[model samples]
Target: MPTYAIGDLQGCYLELRALLDRLAFDPQVDRLWFVGDLVNRGPDSLKVLRFVHDLGEAALVVLGNHDLHLLALAAGNSRHAKKSTLEAVLRAPDRDELLHWLRHRPLLHHDPERNFTLIHAGLPPQWDLAEAQVRAGELEAVLRGTDYQDFLRDLYGNQPDRWSPDLTGLKRLRFITNCLTRLRFCKPDGTLALTEKGSLENHTVGLVPWFRAAGRKTRSDRIIFGHWSTLGYRQEDNVWAIDSGCLWGGALTAIRLDATSLIPIQLNCKGYLAPGQD
Candidate 1:
């Protein structure tokens, strides 16, 4: 009955298998929580997607930025950026099923019993747990509906970096997607800095990591997220940044949900493709 939350697979299926094997994962009883980035920028995106998609009730995954990009690309709204590593997934025999399953996944999930919230990226400073869940549900409905491809087609771009409840149509949907999957740092006034994916020290003067926002309003529960591999693993009062660059020749990381302390499981991520590299 143990549950483990793993960070950014990024299509590192070998490492994912090694780590899970080390944990002796039992699909019959054990539950796995994935922080997302299940594919792209790593070897074996197809294998990873199929493995998780087959896990069914044994696993729960939130949608990461790369995951959304794959969906958008499949919808003919995005183009492969030359160095993209998702070719395998895109060309897989079950590509349709894989992409369809990804688009239907939620942006956020909260476990009241564990007092943990799982998201691909950190929550906006202004959103509490309840607000995040409600907002995620709103976007989830849009993603799972018949108009999903419509939303995916117009999903890129980072203008209107601020959150406004009255924002309508694609702009509104993109805003939510940015916050849930692509967010990293934000201005003091809570404007997302979508282009600034560098280290914390290199951020612009007014930019602050979303999780480090002063007096952040979203402190109701601990948030576990993956996306900023540069930030690696960080634990604060109630936020966990668990993406430790496993696809970058680094080790994969996982945490036990019921334990008070962090228990990490490492694997040899050799020959993996990470961000910023071919």
Candidate 2:
């Protein structure tokens, strides 16, 4: 009856396995909630994807930015960025199934019983719990429907940096996707600054992390998210930023829902990626 929420994997399968073992995770009894980014970067992307897929209902995963990138790449909508590392997943025999599963995973998940909200990235400072669910559903429908490819094709870029219900077409979809997956810092006006992916110290003036927006609105429920590797494991009563960059020589982190404590397992990511990178 234990439930654990884990941070990004990013193809670090050995670390994931070790973390699970540290928790003594029993698929028959415990549930694992993954913050996503299950592939890319480190190594063994294929193994990580396959193992998670095999876990089935034992695991709940929200799509991360990297996970969506894999789907888009599979659909021929994306290309590898510099320092990209997803070849093993792309070449896996089960690539199609893995990608399909990833594409269908929800953009946002809420558990009322636990009073917890899960997403790959944090919610916008403006959205309340209801708005988040409603908007998430809109994008979810598009992602799971015939027009999914169209959504993926227009899923990049930083235009229309602000959220507007009236924003239409690809611009609209891309904005939503970014907010849910890759968002970090934003202007006081709620416009996203997507290009600034550096640590907190590297942030520019007039731009604050999305979670710190003043006079902002989002669910009062606890939100758990990954994607910001620099933030590491942070908890502030109702907010959790658990991505510790295990693929980058950090530790894999997990939190128990019943108790507000976190369990961290270190990784020897040496030689997992290019030398000196991790």
Candidate 3:
């Protein structure tokens, strides 16, 4: 079966439908891997969430930062102001079911047979495949556990921005969450520079895209990720970025993972949110 990895949807259901149609995707045969952020910022978050949730075995998703924010808001963690176009989801009749399914989504997905890993954002240079799996599991357990609300309450911070074996408790979980869902640039020593979300050409000195960081352990493995829409579609050093900024008028993109060469299928999107709107 061919596997198609898609970029962040961000609630653009119309664009998603168009893109899938363009690919002539058959849910019965072609497997879909979504790089998270399935909801928020677009006009149809509810529809998008419902469609993906109903895909069942045909779809695999790793939670994005926006997805996590939705879960946090649903959990009553209102530390940050709610600025997303997620009200449709929050008020949906099936909100509980949808949020429950979203909360259970993994932070990282790996397919050894295909030699590709999926994450919403980049992994720290220090973690090899095994270490990344272990760290992701730790955070996943918290998000899926009974005490998830407690964790969500403390989840919105940028402190402890660097990874360390000695880091513990919420701090450790926060670091892991950021790397898996929101990371972009990092210092040469592997410390995350979370504020730098612009494209690589505009990056400051000594900061490198996490994938290009020195001695990255997963550099040997093919990585498929999103969360850096500003960087657009990138394929370099075994890393593939498919976030074509669908909400920002870029294309909703998908690339076939079953082929020797990644082939992108895109549908031009109507800009739902202008640049700097979010």
Task: Give the root-mean-square deviation of each candidate in angstroms.
Answer: 1.7, 2.2, 0.9
Model 3, span 1-278: residue lDDT tens: 98999999999999988888888888998899999999878888899999998989999999999899889888788765458778888898999999999999999999989989999999999999899999999999999999999999888888898888999999999999999999999999999999887788887888999999999999899999999888888899999999999999988889999998897888888788897776
Ranking by TM-score: 3, 1, 2
**lDDT tens per residue, model 2, 1-278:** 79999998988888889888888999999999999888877777888888999999999999888888877777776445454677677777887787788888998999999889999886677788888898888888898898798777667788888887788877777787889999988988888888887677776888888888775686357899999888877876468898977777666888888775554444434435442352
Candidates 1 and 2 compared: the better one by lDDT is 1
Off by over 4 Å in 1: 274-278
Residue pairs with clashing backbones, model 1: none
Which ten-residue region of model 1 has the weakest summed lDDT?
Answer: 269-278
Identify the leading candidate in terms of TM-score: 3
Off by over 4 Å in 2: 81-83, 260-278
Ranking of all candidate structures by their lDDT, best first: 3, 1, 2
Tens digits of per-residue lDDT for model 1, 1-278: 68999999988888899999999999999999999889887778899999999999999999998888888887787555565677777788888888888888889988888878899987677777777888889889998999888888888898779888888888878888899999999988888899888877776788999988876787657889989888888888778888888988767888888876776666656646545664
Candidate 3: list runs displaced more than 4 Å: none
